[model samples]
Target: MYKLCHQQQVDNACGFYAGHHMLVIAGSKNIRKPEDIVLSTGPLDDWALAGLRESLAKFIMSEVISSKGEFHHPTATY
Candidate 1:
C-alpha cells in the first residue's frame, strides 16, 4: 500500500500506509473478520473505506504507544 500510495502520489502517504497496516493487523488479530477486512479495504469506493482508514490509523497509533517496549529508535543511545 505504501508503494502504491507513493507511486500514485496519493496525498498523505503515511495515512495510506497507516490505514493499510491497521487493516492487516485487524485481520490477524480477529478484531474484524477476515472477509470484512478484505471487503472493506479492498475497494476504493467502499462506503466504509474512509472511516476504516481514519479509525485504523488512530487505533494503530494508540496501540503502538501502549504496547510494552514501545517503539523507539535503535540509534538512540540514551
Candidate 2:
C-alpha cells in the first residue's frame, strides 16, 4: 500500500519539477507566462500546453496546501 509519506514525496518531486519548468519558461525569451509555455508558438500546439497548465496547477496547489495549511477550494473536483 502506498503511504501518505510516499505520496507526499512524489508530490514534492512534482512540485520541484513544475517550479523548475516555470523558471525555465520565465528565463526564456518566448515563454513568459505559464500559459505562454503551454502555447509554445512553435512545434507544439495549444492543447498540449493546456494539459501542462492543468498538471502544473494541481502540483502547485498541492504544495501550497501542504506547506501553508490554509487556503483551499471547498468544492474543487481536481
Candidate 3:
C-alpha cells in the first residue's frame, strides 16, 4: 500500500488522489472553502459546485498519478 507522509495526508489534493486510487480517505476536514480557492470564479449552487470540485479533484489526482508525484497540490490546476 502506498502511504502518504504527514504533509501529504493533510493536503486536500493528496487526500482526493488517495481516495480515488487507493480507496483511502483522508483529511476531509482539510477541504478548503470555495471562497478560499483561488481557482473558483464565483458562487455556485450546491450541486454545480460539488460537480466542479469533483472534476477538479479528479484532475489533480490524475496529474499526480501520471506525473509520479511531480505534479501535485497547490501546483496542479484544472
> In lDDT terms, which candidate is top?
1
Model 2 misplacement above 4 A: 1-42, 66-78
TM-score each candidate.
0.28, 0.30, 0.30
Q: Give one digit per residue, the lDDT tens place, for model 3 in 1-78.
A: 333323333344544433333221222345555333222223334575465478766876776655555575555454
Clashing pairs in 2: none
Q: Give the lDDT of residue 34 in candidate 1.
A: 41
lDDT, residue 75, candidate 2: 55
Error of 2 at 37 (Å): 20
Worst 10 residues of 2 by lDDT: 1-10
lDDT string, candidate 2, 1-78, tens digits: 311111223432455444445655567776445444432223323464466668668766775444553555555554
Local accuracy by lDDT, each model: 0.50, 0.48, 0.45
TM-score of 3: 0.30
Which runs in model 1 stand beyond 4 Å of their true positions?
A: 1-8, 30-43, 53-78
Predicted structure 3: lDDT? 0.45
Model 1, 1-78: lDDT tens per residue?
212222323555445555655666565766454444432233344444576667766765654544433564445454
